[model samples]
Target: MKKLNFTSITKYTILFLIALLLTVTAIVFLEGRKSKNISLWITPASYFNEGWYYFDSDSRRQEIDSLPVRIPADKFGTARIYHKMVRSSHYCMYIDYYAHHQAVKAFFNDELIFEYAPPSNPGWLKSYRSFHNLIAIPLNRDGILCIETKASISSTAGEFGQIRIGSRDELLNRIVSERLPQFLLGAVLIVLGFILFIITAFYLRVAFDRTILYFTLLLIFLGVWQTEESRLLQFFIGFQALHWFFEYMMQPFILILSFLFIKELFINKKHPALIILFACITLSIFTQLILQITGIAQMTSTLFMINSMFIVVFAYILVLINLNFEFARKSVKVIFSISIALCIVSFIISSAVKHHKNFTDPILYLGIVFLFISISIFVIQKTQKQFNAVRSAEIYKKLAFLDISTGVSNQTAWYTLIENFSADGIKLDKYCMFMFDMNNLKTINDQYGHLEGDKAIRSFCECLKRAVGKSGDIYRIGGDEFICLCKNIDYTRATQIENMFDYYVKNQTESKVQFTAAHGYAFFSPSSKADFIQAQSMADKAMYENKILSKKGRS
Candidate 1:
């Protein structure tokens, strides 16, 4: 792994801050400029089509999916409707409307203004209705609007949702402003989930427990579910059965997934409640699916909320039990607190929306945003700790093996390395060993101080490194003694390496004291009778002889 530098970190930090600033600035701007929603006119049931009719055939009006909001119906034929109202003098500069599943031909004040035909496939709808316009009637006094929509079983289930008008720029701005945080937050959570998933499955592999994996999957489900619940999803899903599934099914699914995630996170022993909770949720989900699919049950947001609350209640009780667990980490406590808080807040908001029709709150999205942000911080901290631990272990291993005085492998490391190779069944014949002895080291230490002697030793080690390069491993075997092991090298090259070190020392000018060493080398082949122990003794004897010869030359 590559090391992170200050430059790179600073660059990334600056970039992230800039992006965050821009996003916040834009959000503030959108929030500051309030876009007041003004309903133009309500669709009233009518029997007349105003002399305009196309695709009046029965085959084109097959039932597919029900709408979220109710509109006046005509079960036998298309529900022909018209509305007469005055546009407010304070009308904003923009207009937005959602005539769910309606094939519309609209007119304002007896003048044909707009036209749109529903597609065969329901997928033509997207998450946002930026361009899906039913009509472009100019806001004026005494405006008369007409819409001919196909009918369904329910009163207003066929033509669903409301037609809203607001400022053009402000409407688009509000659309993004309201939904942006949820979209971005959900996207980020999804990415984090994928990262954790990959880490568990690939990077960490076998080490990590399944708790993290379950958490990752829970996050993914939450993100997708949250996105689906947002107003933005209306444009993406159109008016298909998928909309109901997302609104109803994903809620219970996330709740159940969270149960599993929590169980794995802190509970080593699965409580009976865990199995019962899972079985009940599983049964509810499948039962709901069967009923809805078979048309026996009509799914509604109220019923969905009830199911979600049931799971949430059980989850809270489980969390309360685990929060008191003696072995739980502080992180686990924090997560528990956060989950409970979010659950309480969400339940209140959901209940308020269900009972009180006029109530609206954007603060609900903040819970999701905060939850993921908290999880992201935890992930970063945990991953960083793991990385630091591995790096520290490597550093300690290096420290244990290194000779502190000369930065060469110490005797202990030398034996370990040899043993590892020998244990692997590699014979000494595959290696060439050169032993070195520093001549007159005790005399130098007596003449000068130990510091200068140490300097001389380090200088000799440096010279040896320059001579050997990457050809072999060097070890400070003992006091004033060193050894080099070169694998697959012949005696000739070992002799050349020894001479290079000797030449480098003789030509040295930077050091205050001259450094000299005597070396003797021996090559071992597979057929050789001498073991490594015997070869080391032979090398030491030859090195002492060389030292004696050098002493005579000095005389």
Candidate 2:
């Protein structure tokens, strides 16, 4: 048997464990804080989940052990749920429940109290389909509470949610408070998405990848969907139609954005399966919209079809992951795979347990949060890697043209500038070139050491740079030899610069060794029509003459 190596696997396992621990810690901390806040002000409401009986339109009654019991898919007609309410001393008692795509009528002691039957139009029916119902119940009167629900479409049939009884204020508070964490989470995602959008637009545009843009969009849509699903917005907006429209419309977009994000994450490879998936989803969304507009079918009725499409999407993602397993980064592969698995499991569970519809699915929320976190990590890592690459390239380019020893443009940069000037057909008369050779550098090196020689050379270069400032460019072409190219300078300005350079060299006191340089400048005459090489020769010749004169004066 051959021995197997698990070194890479072990390393990634450790990383995944650490990441998981941190994520769990953060969730626990947030939940703990929420729990503490809830305890402070929220009063728990009594849920009437059991001891109920349901009757169909045919007058056939069936025993319901719990409040939330799914009616048969085939059953579509008027239905009634009867539960005896306990007499309460509270002056204002209220019963709250959620009705999905069903017209509701509430009665107490065979007397009608509340009705929510909307117009028969499909559009009107869709707008009123799903909502939180809060009915004021009479207090100090013992009577049977009858909730009559009617569902015309079979898809919307049999879905009932938990009923709660409490004071009106208490029940309202409970409803909002229960979904507050989810609402806030969604709001945070939306805010974060917009912030990322602004940053990418203004600051990171050059270095940003489309992957991050897609991720930002995913966050925004996901937040919108989550917030809408929480149904807390209905309380404030007071427009069930608008909320319902957004609730259904945002789903396909969220799915599309997710796919786009994943596609970009895989280096934008256009897989055939992915293309087909995109086309299919797009077609389905448009078809659903058309059906909704024509009143032929409602978006809610086609949810199973959408759910099936997503199942295909998740399956395709798994297949794609497997195909790219060897090439994907360890962190990305592990984190993304785990998150997708969690999301798929949660989605399946949420779909399977349809009867329990009191609050937004927390497990699905966790999976989504985890997936977003994983995407954030991947995108940030990729952006950081690209940033490092760009920074390194810039540093390399700068170092290529810089003289590390003298803090000046090096010989390579001088040649490059000359090439550029020649390529652009620059006239020699537009610029003046100066040649400089440091005096007594050999003697300084022989007497004081090479370090002293280097100091002298640097001192001379600094004097030249300060005198020239922004008006000219300086290059250290060789040891103790420098060149200055000044463009668009007149004779008077050139003289002033030369005088300044001499003054700076004379007054220099930073080094123990005296720093002096012999420099010669030549203005290119238009009459001579000289090339740069000839002009450089003229400057070099003048520099030698200046050196000889300086030596004679010293003697």
Task: Look at candidate 2 and tell me the lDDT of residue 499.
Answer: 88
Identify the runs in model 1 with alpha carbons over 4 angstroms from their true place.
1-80, 84-95, 99-144, 148-160, 166-174, 187-221, 227-257, 267-269, 298-339, 355-363, 373-392, 409-460, 466-500, 503-555
Question: What does the lDDT come to for candidate 2?
Answer: 0.76
Q: Write the per-residue lDDT of candidate 1 for residues 30-110, one digit (tens) a residue.
A: 997797656443332122212222222353523323223333354543564455456767432223445443455666666
TM-score of each: 0.58, 0.67
lDDT: worst 10-residue window of model 1: 44-53
Output the number of the lDDT-best candidate: 2
TM-score for candidate 1, residues paired by index: 0.58
lDDT of 2 by residue, 3-120 (tens): 5469877988999999999999999998887663445555778897888887655668778888677764334456678887777777558889777778889999999999986456
Q: How many residue pairs clash per model?
A: 12, 1
Looking at model 2, the pairs that clash are 71-158
Indicate the TM-score of model 2. Answer: 0.67
Residue 199 in candidate 1, Cα distance off native in Å: 10
- How many clashes (backbone atoms < 3 Å, residues ≥3 apart in a chain or on different chains) does model 1 have? 12
